[model samples]
Target chain A: MSAFSTGAVTLAPHRVAAMVLRYLYLLRSSWTRLLELIYWPAVQLLVWGFLQFYIAQNSGFFARASGVFIAAVLMWDVLFRGQLGFSISFLEEMWSRNLTNLMISPLRPIEFVCALMIMSLIRLAIGMVPVTFLAIAFFGFNVYGLGLALAAFFVNLILTSWAVGIVVSGVLLRNGMGAESLAWTLMFVLMPLACVYYPVSVLPDWLQVVAWALPPTYVFEGMRALIMEHVVRVDLMVEAFVLNALYFSAGVVAFLQLLKSARRVGSLLQTGE
Target chain B: MSQAAEPAIAVDQLVKVYKTTRAVDGISFALEPGSITGLLGGNGAGKTTTIAMIMGLVTPTAGTVKVLGAEMPRLRYHVLHKMNFESPYVDMPHRLTVRQNLKVFGRLYAVEDLDGRIAALAREFDLSEFLDRPTGKLSAGQKTRVALAKALINSPRVLLLDEPTASLDPDTADWVRAHLERFRKERGATVLLASHNMAEVERLCERVIIMKRGRIEDDDTPRRLLIRYGRETLEEVFLDVARGRGEAREAAQ
Candidate 1:
C-alpha cells in the first residue's frame, strides 16, 4: 500500500443512522424477509381473533377483540424478529469475518449496539402497518386505540425488546451460532408468560410475580391502561421505561465488554481472515 | 530502527495465549510500505493471529502492532476506510446476490458514484454475468473476485490479503495480480499479502516476509533471497524456509 497524507476520516452519527435506515429500507424492499417476520404472527392473530369472537359474543370488547388482538399480535410479533435481529446479526458478521473488519473501523461499541436497536425498531415499525390494516379489514379487529395505544405500544415494544435484545446479544457473544435459536425461542416463550394481553393479576400469584419481573409485562400493562382505561399510569410507564433503559444500557455495557473480550479472542482466532 | 526499519506492518514483543497454549510468542517485524509482504506459516503459525491484531479485530495479550503509522486496535479506525482485507477463511453472505453484497459495502465505503464504481469493478473483474446471482451459487473463483471487489471498494490505503487468490485459476489469478499492481500504482496503497502461492507473491510482492511458528524468519526482496539461498527461483526458496532448511542464510548473516 502506498502512503498518502489523506484527510481525517470522521465518524458521523447521522451517517450511522443513515446506514441503519438503509437496513430498514432493505427489509421493507424485500417482500419475503418482511413477510417472514409478519406472516406467522398474523396467522396466530387471525386464529386467536376468531376464537375470541366465538367465545365472547355481543361483548363490546369482543366486537373489538379482533383489532386489539391484532394489535397485540403485531406488537408481540416484534419479539421473534427483534430477538432474531440481535442473535443472527452477529453471526452474519462473524461468519463473514466482517466483524473483524467492522471492529477495525470507526464504528464503536455504542454505534454497533445502537445500530442493532435501530434495525429492530424499524422492523417492528414498518412491519406493523400492514398487519394493522389487515386486522382492521379482515376480522373487524378493534381500532379504538389506533392512535394512542398503538403509539404507546410502539414505544413500549421498542423499549422492552431492547431489554430482551441486551440479553440475547450477551448470549450470542458468549456462544457461537448455537445460542441464537435459543434466543429466538426465549422471546417466543417469554412474551406469553409476560401476559401481553391479560393482566398478571389474572394468573396465580406466583406466576404474577414472574410476570411482573419481565419488562414486557409492564409495557403490555401500560398499553392496556392507555387503551382500555385511558389512564396515564405514569408510575407504570416510568417503571417500564426505567427498566427498559436499564436493560438496554446494561446490555450495551456488557456487549462492549464482550466486544473487548471478543477482540482478544478475535485477535487470536479471527486471524488470517 | 537502523536495519529493521519502516515495516509497512510491525508487531513488537507480541504474545497471545489461549486457555492453554501460547498462539504467538514474542514475535516482531516491520514491513515497508508499497510492498506485498508474505506471512507464510502452517495452520496455527500465528499468521492469522498476528493479522487480527493488526486489523484491531483481536486484542493482543501483551504486544503492540502498528499499521500504516498508527498503533493498531486503537487508532485502527482512523485508517479503516484507507485499508481493506480479504481472506478465504471468511465467507460472504450466500443468501444475498453478488450485486447486493457489492452495494452494501459500496455504501459503507461511501464510494463516490457507487453505481458507476460497481459497474466498473464488475467489468474490470469480469464478474458481470454472475453479479446478479446469489453468492452461494458462484464458483469458488467467482467468490474470490467478489470478495476482492469488496476489499477494493474504498480505494484502500492498506490492503491485507490472506490466501487472496486461493481458489482462482492461473489466468484469473494473474488478472487479479495485474489489477492489484494497477491499484498500487494509481493509489499508492500499501499491501501485505499472506499466501501459499510463492509464484503469485514473487510476481506481485516487491518484498517478502516468511513466518514459521509465529516468528519472522526471512525478510528480503524475493529475487535476492532466491539467489542468496542458492535456489533457482522464489518458489524453491519458499520450500527451504518452510521446511526448516533456510536457517543457514540467517546464521551466515
Candidate 2:
C-alpha cells in the first residue's frame, strides 16, 4: 500500500503548490487578467489620494495626519484583493466547468483552500505593491511607514477576507454562478460595519457594537491609532487576531458543511454557469 | 474450492437521494480487475450520479461503494491517487496550454518525473503538435485527447469515463477507443464507462449494466443482451428499455 493508505487524510504540500502553480499559469497566460490585478487598486489609490489631499488642505484634523485616508485606502485594498484573490481563483474553475475535474482529483478540499489562500497572498502582493509605491510617489504617503504594525494589520485583515471568501465559495459550491455576485458585493456589506474610513466612535452606540465585532474594524481602529496617536495598540491587534481566528475557523466549517451538502445533492457534477 | 478474488469495484445497495428524487437507488454490482464495464442509461437514469459516487465526488444517501477495496468519499484518499476520471462535460482551464494543463495535473497527482510523463502522453495521444496551444483553441477531438491525457497522467488503476467520445469524429473516436483498449490491456486497469453510444459499448465493454430511473434494468454481455432482447443491435435494446419495454415482446408473453 502507498503512504496515502493511512487512516487519516494527510495534507500534501506538493498538491497545494501544484494548485498555486495552476493559478499562476492561468494568470500569466492572460495579459488582461495580469493587468486587471494592478488596475483597480491603482485607480482607487489615485482617486482617494487626491481627495485626501483636498481635505487635508482645508481641515486642521486632516492636515495633522495627511496620510490617514491614503493609508486607509491602501489597507482596504489588501482586504479586497485578498478576498477577490481567493474567490476569483475558485470562480475561474467553475467558469471553465473544471470544478468537477478538481473535485475528482486526489487533491483534497483543504489543499485546494490552502492553494487559494497562497494565491490570495500572491495576488494581493502583485496588486498592492505598485499602488503602494504610487501612493509614495504621487501623494508622499508611504503606507509602509506604519512599519511592523503593517504586518499585524495585513495578517488580521487578510485572514478576515479569507473567512469571507471561504463562506462565499461555499455558497457558490451549493448555488453555482447564481451566487457569484456575493464575491464582489459581500465584502462591501462589511465595509460599513468594518469602519474602514472612520473610527468606531463615529458609529451610533448600537452600531458600534456591530462594528467592534468585525476584525477589520479593530485593524482600522488600530491603524488610526498608529497614524494619529503614534502609539501601537497591541491590545487591539490581539483582539483582531483572536476574532480572525474564530471567523476563519467558522469559514472552514461552513465550507466543508456546504461541500458535504453539495455532494448529498449531487451538485458537484452539475456546478457551473 | 478457491475463493474468488476481490473485485476492483464493489457496490452494495448503492443509493443517492437528492431531496425526493432518487438519483441512484439500491443498486448492486461488482467489477473484476482489468475489466471494462459500460454503464448504460438514459439522461435521468443516474449513470453520472453513480459514477460520481464511485469517484467520491458525491455522497450516497445509503448503501456503500468500494473502489480498489477502499470505501468512497471517506477513505477516498487511500485510492484517489490510483484512480482518475474524465468526461466531456467537465473542462480544464481554457487559457492554459495543453502541456501546461498536463503538467499541472501531473503535479497534482504527484507523479514522478512529470516532464517525462507529459512527453510520453503527448506522444501517445498525438498531442505533440498542439501541446503549446491554449486548450480553448483546440478542436473538439483535440480537447477529448487532451482530457484523456489528463485522466491518464496519474497512471490510475481505476478509470471512470463518462461519454469519453461524445463529440469526436468517427476517425478520432475509433482512435480513442483503440487507445483505451491498449491502455487497459497493458496496465490491467479497470474502467467503468458510462455512455449512450451503443456501438462503442458493444465494441469496448465486456459487460454492460443497463440502468433506468436509478435502477439497473439488465446486466449481461452485449451478445447476451442482443439475444435476450431479440434485437440485432444494442441500440435496439437501448431503445426498448428507454421506451419502457422491459423485455422482448415474445418473452414478456
Candidate 3:
C-alpha cells in the first residue's frame, strides 16, 4: 500500500475551503477591508462614466458606440480585481509570516492555488458587481447585455489575470516583498497592448504584431465586435481561450518551481517586507 | 516495522546550501518515538534551517529527511497532518479573533469536533476571556499561549518548536514549560525543541544536540555534556560550543 493513499486524491475540497474561510474571516473582521474592495472599482467607473458621457455627446464616432468605455472599464476591473484578489491572499500569508505554517500543513500547493482562484472569483464579484450596476445606472451601459458573450470575455480576461498573478507571486517568492509592487503594476503593462479602448487596427503594424500575441487583445477585439457591429466573434474568443491556457500553465509551472527554489534556498521563512 | 522500532524523525547527511553559505551541513541524527530532543545552537548555527527541513518547509540540497516513514517535501503530504510546528516569529492573522484563528487552523488540520477542541484548548490555556478578542490585541504572553493552542490543534505526533517561550515572563514561561511536559506525557508526542534557554533544555529535554556553524558540535545528555565540557551548566557548555572552545576541549582531551 502507498503511504500517501490515505489522503491521495488530487484535490481535497475541505482543505481548499479552509483557506477560503481563513480569508473570509479576515475580510468580515474589518469594515474598511470590505469597503476597500468595492471602493476603487466604483471610483474608476464614475470617472470613466462621465468622460464617456461627454465624448458621446461631442463625437459622432463615440455616439454610435457610447457604451464601449463603460464596458471596457467594467471588464478591466474584472481583470484587475481577479489578479489583485489572488496576490492579496498570498501576500496576506506572507505579511503575517503564516506561509511557513500553511506550507507545513496537510494542504497541498495545488489546493492552495485552488483556494486562491476561488477567492479571486469571490473578490472579483464583490468589486465588479456594484460597478457593473453603477455603469448601467450612470451611463446606461448594461455590461450584461452582451449575454453569453460577456461570460467568455470575463473568463478569458480572468484566466489571463491568474496567469499574470501567478507569475507575479512567483517573482515575489524568489525576490521577496521588495517585488511586491509587481502585483499591482504588472497587469497595467498589458492594458495598452491589450487595446482596451481602441481597435487593434488603430495600432501601427509593428505594435499590432505584439498586441496580437496577447490573450487580452483577442478579448477586447471580441468585445468591440459585439458592441459596435452587433456580431459575436466566436473565433476571437476561441483564440483567447487557447492563448490563456498556455500562459496559465506556464504561470503555474513557474510558481511551483520558484517555491521549490525558495525551499532549497531556505527563503520561505524569511519572506516578509 | 513496529512503531517503537522505527524512528519518529530520521535525518541522514542532510545538507542545505543557500548560495554561498551552508545553512545546514551534512547533519545526521534520529529520534526514537515520543522523545524530546533539544536542538541548541547560537545565531546562524543552522538550528532553524534543520527544523524547517524536518517540517518539510525547506528542501535538503543533499541526503534525506524522513518523518514518520515519508521523505520530506516529496512525500510530505502523506504525513503532514501528523506534524505541527510553533514559533514566536510566525503569527496568525492579527485581525482574526483568538477563537476564529483557532477555528481556521482546526479546519485546516481537519480536526474532528473542532468546536469542542477549541473550547478545550481555550480552557486549558486560560484563553476563555480573550477568545473573542482580536489576536493582535492580546499581550505577548497571551499570544504565545494562543500560538501553542494553534500548534496543538492537530494533535500532531511530531512537534517542532523554535524558541517557544521567547517573550513570556518567568512565571508564565515556567507554566508553559509545565504544560508542554504534560502534553508530551499525555500524548506520547515526539518534540524537537530549538531554544536558547539552557535551563529549559536541561529541565525538559532527555537528549540535547548542540550545533555550531551549521554542524553538530556535540550530541549527548545535558549531564554528559556538562561533564565532558567541564562546565557547571548547559549555558556554559552552549557558550563553549558557540565560541569554538568545543574543538579546543576535544583536542586537549
Candidate 4:
C-alpha cells in the first residue's frame, strides 16, 4: 500500500534520460524494421545512383559529386531511416498492443517522445556508414573532410525524423494500421522534394524556398556546404537547427494534445476506440 | 467493517460514457486492503470500462477515481510505480525474450534484488525452460505466465488482473491461483480481478460485484448471493446477470 501511492512515480529527468537510452533497444530488437530503414535508400543508391554516375562521366560529375556522397546522399539516408526508426518502433508497439504497457507505466508522454527521439538518433547513427558505403561503392567518389559537419547533420536528421515520428505515432494510436502507411509515405513525399540526389541550387528558386521550409533540405544544404565550400556557413547550420527544433516541438505539442484527446475519447482502452 | 480502515481503492460515483451510451453509469465502490474484489459482467457491460477509468487508462465523462486515496493522473505516477497489471488481451514486445521482457518491466518498477525477483518468478511459474525464448513464440499458457511474472515484478500492493487464466490449462490455472494466493498472503495486497470464470470467482473473490447495462446489479459474497438468489453456484449467478436476469432476480428480492 505504501508503494502504490508513490506519486504514481512520474518519470524524473534521469528516468526520461534512461528511457531515451532504453528506447534504442527497439532498433536492435527488430532487424526487419531496421532493414526497412536501409532498404529504400539502398535501392535509390544502387539504381538511380549508378545512373547519376553514367550522366556524370563526361560532365565532370565525379569532381562535382566527389563530396556529394557524404554531404547530400548520406544525410538523406539519415532522414528516411530516422523516420523509419520512429515509425517502425511505434508501429511495432501498436501491432503488438504493447502501447498500453508503455502508456500505463510511469513513463510520461514527453518521456515516450524523447525515447522515440533516442531511437531515431541511434538509427541515423548506424545508417551513416551503410549509406556512405553504398553510394561510395556505386559512384566511386571521395566524400571525406566532412566528418565535423557529419555529426551535426546526423543530429539534425535524427531530430527532424523523430519529430515526424511523433505526429505519425499519434495518428497510428488512433487509427491502428490505417495510419502506418504514412510512415512510409512521409519519407516518400519528402525524398524528391528535399533534393537529396541534386542540389537545391539545381532546383528552381521557388522550389528551393519550399525545400528551405523543410528541415531535411537544410540538413542536405548544410552537408553540401561543408563538402563543396569547405566553409562553415553559420546561418545555414542555424537554419537547420531551428527548423529541426520547430518540427520536434510541433511533434511534442501534437503528441501531447492528441494523447490527451485520445484519453478523453478513451481510445487507450481499445486501440481501435 | 468500519469505514475508518485505510481503503486500498475508492471510486466515488465513477461514471464513463461512450458517445450517448453510459459505459459505466455512476458506480461507486471501495475495496479494503487485502480484499479480492471480483467484477463480473458480460461483454459490453462496462466492466473493463470501469476498470480502465480506475487504472487512469480511461477518462470518465464525469466522476472521480482515487486509487490508494490519491486523485488519479495527478498522483497517478506515484501510485502506479507500486502497481502492476496483467491482461490476456495485452502483450509485450514480440522481439524481446521472456528474460528481456521481465528485466525491462522489473527495471521500470525499479525493483531491488532484480535478479532474485525474476529468478524467483521464473522458478515459481516454471518459466526457466523457455525464459530465453522470444515472448511472441510462447504458447498462450506460457505467455500468460510471462505476463503474470511481469505484473508481479514490483510485488505490487494492488494487482489488476483481467482474465488471469483465459487460455490456460487446468494445471497451469491452478498453479496461477496458488501463486496469486501466495503473493496475497505474503504482501497483504488488494486484488481487483475481472474474470468470466465462475469457479474462479467462487474460489477467489470474497465479494463479487455484478454489473449490468453500465451499473451494478448486485454485490455480495458468492455463496450468499447463490443462496439468496436461489442459485447453486456462481456460474448460475453469472448466467443470470449476463443474460439480463440479475436485475429481475434482485427486484424479486
Candidate 5:
C-alpha cells in the first residue's frame, strides 16, 4: 500500500507544474500581467493607509491602536488577492479558449485545481509581498509582528479563499462566460459576514451566527485580539482551521461534481465561447 | 483485455442529447490504426459534438466511446497522453509567445526533451522566425500553424483535428495537409480529421464518415463516396450529403 501510494503521489506534480507553467509563461511574456499584479494591491494599500492615518488622527478609539485599520486592510487583501488569483487564472484559460485543450490533455480536473491553487500562491506572493513591505515603509506598521501566528492566519484565510474560489470556478465552468463577474464579486459578498475590520460582537445576534459560520471571521477576530489585546488565542485559530477544513473539502467536492455535470452537458467545450 | 489489433478508435452506439436537441444519435464506427479518416458534415451536423465525445470533452448521453481500447471519459487519462486534438474554434493562451505556448502544452503532455520537441515542430511548421511573437499578434495562418504545432507536441498516436486548415489560402492549406500526411506516415498516427474542405479530405483521408443531423449518413472511401453519388468530386458528394440526398443515394445503391 505504501509503495503504491508513493508511486501515485510522484506522478502528479509534473502535470500540475505544467499547468502552473502555462500561467507563469503568460506572466513572464506579458509586462502588463506583472504590472497588474503589483499595481492594484499597492494602490489599495496606499489609499487605505491614508484612510487609517486620517482615522488615527481624528478618533480617540482608533488613536490607541494606530495600526488596526492598516492591518485589517492588508489582511483583507490577503484573502481577496488569494481568491482572485485562483479564480482569475482559471478565467484566463477560459478567455483564451484553452480550457478544452487543457481538459483534453492528460491533466485531470483535480490536477487542474491543484495547479490553480499553486498559481494562486504565486500570484498572491507577487501581489502581496511588495504591498506588505510598503505597509511597513509607508505606514510604519509591520504586520509580521504577529509572528508565527501571522503564518497561521494567512493559511486559514488563503484556504478559505480557495474554498470560495473553487466554487466560483465550478460555477463558471457550468454556466460559461456569463458568470465571469463572480470571480471578482463573490468575495465581497462575504465581506460583511467576515467581520474583517471589527469584532463579531459588533454584528446583530442573527448576523453574528452567520459571521461565526465563516472561517475568516475567526481569523480576523483573532487578528484583532492579537493586535489590540496582545493575547494569543489558540482556540480561535483551531476553530478557523477546522472550519476551513470543512469548507475546503466541500468546495473541492462541489467543484469536481460541477465539472462532471459540465462535461455531461457539453458545457466544458462551450466555456470559452 | 485489449488486443494489439483493436482499432485505434471505436465508437459504438454513441449518443449525445442536449436539453431539446439530440446532437449525436446512436453513431458507431471504428478507425483502423495508422489510417487517416475524415469526419465530414456541415454546421450543426454533429461533427463537432461527435469529436468532442471522442476526446472525452463531452460525455455521451448513451453508448460507448473507446479510444485506444479504453472506455472514455472513464479511462480517459489512461490514453489521453497518447492523443491530441486541434480545432480552429479553440485557441492557446494568446498573450503567451508561440514558444511559450508550445512549451506549456509540451509540459502538460509531459513530452520528454520538450525543448527538442518544440525546436523540431517550430522548424517543421516554419514557426522559428515568429516563435517569440505573442500568439494573438500572429496572422491567422501563423496562429493555425502554432495551434497545429501545439497539437503535435506530445507526438500523439491518435490525432483529432477540426477544420485544421480553415481560413487559410490554398497554398498554406495544401502545405498544412502535406504536413499532416507526413506526420501520419512518420509516426504511424491514426487521424480523425473533420474538415469542410472536401478536397483536403480527398487528398488525406483513406476513408470518410459523413454525418447529418447527428447520424452517419454515409461511410466509405472518398472515391467510393464519389462513385456512389455519381459525382466528379467529393465536394459535390458533400453537397449531396448536406442536402440529405446522400441517404437516398445510399438506399438506391
Candidate 6:
C-alpha cells in the first residue's frame, strides 16, 4: 500500500492548508504584498508589449510573426512566477525564523513541497492573469489563441520552473541565508538556455545542445511552432513532459538530501541568521 | 521487549561533531514521563545542540535519540505530533496576527476544536487584546506568550524548551514559570528545558543536568547539586560547574 493510502503515513490536508493559510495571511495583511503579486507582471507585460511592437515594425523576422514575442513574454512569466513563488515562500519561513517550528511539526518534506506548489499556483494566477489580459488589449495579441496547446506549454514550463525552485531551496538549506540570491538568479541563468524570446536554432551549435536539454526550450520552440506556422508539435510536448519528469525527480531528491544534510549540520534551527 | 516502557526521551551516546569542534560530544540521558528536567550549560556548552538533537532538528553524529519510544530522525514523523518545541530565539511570521499564528499552528497539529483551543490559550496567556495585532508589532512579552501558546497548540506529551523566558521582566518571567508549572501539573507533559537562568531551573526542574564542553559534568537534583558543591544556590553550583570546579570537586572526592 502507498504511504498515503496506509494509515501509517499520509499527508494531512489540514496541515497543508495551514501552511497555505500562513502565506495567505501574510498576503492578506499586507497591501504591499498584495500589490507586489500583480505589479511586476503588469509592468513586464506593458514594457514587453511595446518592445514587441517596436521589433515587429522594424525587424523583418518579428514582422512576419507579430505575436511571437508578446506570446513568449506572457508564457515566460508563468515560468518565472512559478519559480519565484515557490522559492520566495520558502524564504519567508526562514526570514521569520519559523523553519524550526515547521520542521519539528508532523508536516513531512513532501507535504511542505506540496504546500509551496499550491502557493506558487495561487501566486502565478494572481500575477499572470491580469497581465495576460493586458497583453491582449495592448499588443493585439492573445496568447490564449494558441488554444489548448497553451495549457500544455504552461504545465510543462511551470513544472520545470518548480524543479529549478526546488534545487535553489535545497541550496539555501544546505548553505545558509547567504545563498538566498540563488533563488532569484537560478531561473534567469536558464533563460538564455531556455531560448525564451528566441528559437533554439538562433544559438550556436554547441549551446544549442544545452538548449535542447532544457524543458523550456521545447516549450518555447513549440510556442513558436504554433504562433509562426500554426502547427501543433506533439513530439515537443512529449519531450518536455519526459524531461520535466526527470528534472522534477532529481530536484526532489536533491531537496530531500540537502534537508538531511542541514539536519546533520544543525542548520535547520539557525537558518534565518 | 522489556524496554517497551521507554522514558519520554532517551539519548544514548549522542554525539555531534562539527568539522573539528565537537558541538555535542558523546552524552546520554533520559527523562521519565511527566518530569521536567533542566539542561543547564554555559556558552558553547551544547545545550541548544542537545535540545535540537532531541527534537530531531539535528542529527547526532554517533548516537540514537528516542523520543516517546520512537528512534528520532527516523521515526520522528510518527511521534512529531506528540512532541513540540519552543525557543525565544525563533519567531513566527511577522506579518501574521497573533491569533492567525496560533490558528495556523493549531491546524498544523490537527488539534480538534481549534477555535476553542485558540480562545482558551488566548485567555490563559492574557493575549486577547493583542491577538488581533500583527506578531511583529507585539511587545516581547506578548510575543513570548504567543510562542508558548504555539508550542502548546498540539498539547504535546514531550515539550522541548530553550530559554522559554529569556528576556522577560522578573514578574512576567515568574508568571511564565508558574504557567509552565501549571501546564506540567495539568497535562503531565515531559519537559526538557535548556536555560541559563539558574533560578528558573531550580524552581521548575526536579532534576538538573549540568553540561560543559559538550558533555554532562553533573546530573542531580537542585538540592543535591548545591550540597555536593557546598553552594547555597544553583547559581553558585552552576558557576562552579561552568568554571570547571566540578571536575576538581570530583577529583577531591
For candidate 1, write residues B1-253 as lDDT tens digits: 6543566677799887776778787887776666567776667777777777788777788989887677888787667767788887676666667887777666656678889999988987888999888787888888888888988887887888888888788988888889888888887778888888888888888887777776777778888888779998777887887787778666767
Off by over 4 Å in 5: A1-11, B249-253
Best by lDDT: 2
Could you give candidate 3's per-residue lDDT for residues A1-273 as a string of tens digits? 011324444677788888999999998988998899999999999998899889989999899987888888888888888999999998998888888788888887778888999999998888888888888887788888899999999999999999998988888887789889999899899899999989999899999999999999998899889999999999999999999999999999999899888887777878874
DockQ of each: 0.40, 0.73, 0.68, 0.49, 0.68, 0.72
lDDT of 2 at B119: 92
Per-residue lDDT for A253 in model 6?
94
Which consecutive 10 residues in model 1 chain A have the weakest lDDT in total?
Answer: A1-10
State interface RMSD in Å for all models: 4.6, 2.0, 2.7, 3.1, 2.8, 2.5
> Going through the candidates in order, what fraction of the true interface contacts does each contain?
0.41, 0.94, 0.86, 0.54, 0.95, 0.95
Tens-digit lDDT track of model 4 for A1-273:
012224433335544554554455555677875686667667766665666566667678555755465345556667777787777666767777887777777666765666666666666656556766765675665454465676677677778778888898887765566676898887778877787766788888788888888877777766666666776666777788898888888987887778777777788867732
Locate the minimum summed-lDDT window of 10 residues in model 4 chain B.
B69-78
Candidate 6 chain A: worst 10 consecutive residues by lDDT? A1-10
lDDT of 1: 0.70
The best candidate by DockQ is: 2
- If you assessed candidate 2 against the hidden native complex, which CAPRI class would it receive? medium
Each model's lDDT comes to 0.70, 0.92, 0.90, 0.77, 0.90, 0.90
Error of 2 at A252 (Å): 0.9
TM-score of 6: 0.97
TM-score (C-alpha, index-matched) for candidate 1: 0.85
Regions of model 1 farther than 4 Å from truth: A1-18, A21-30, A58-71, A85-101, A104-106, A144-146, A202-210, A226-232, A267-273, B1-7, B95-99, B128-134, B247-253
Report the error of model 2 at residue A148, Å.
0.9
- The CA root-mean-square deviation of candidate 5, after full C-alpha superposition on the true structure, stands at 2.2
Every model's TM-score: 0.85, 0.97, 0.97, 0.90, 0.96, 0.97
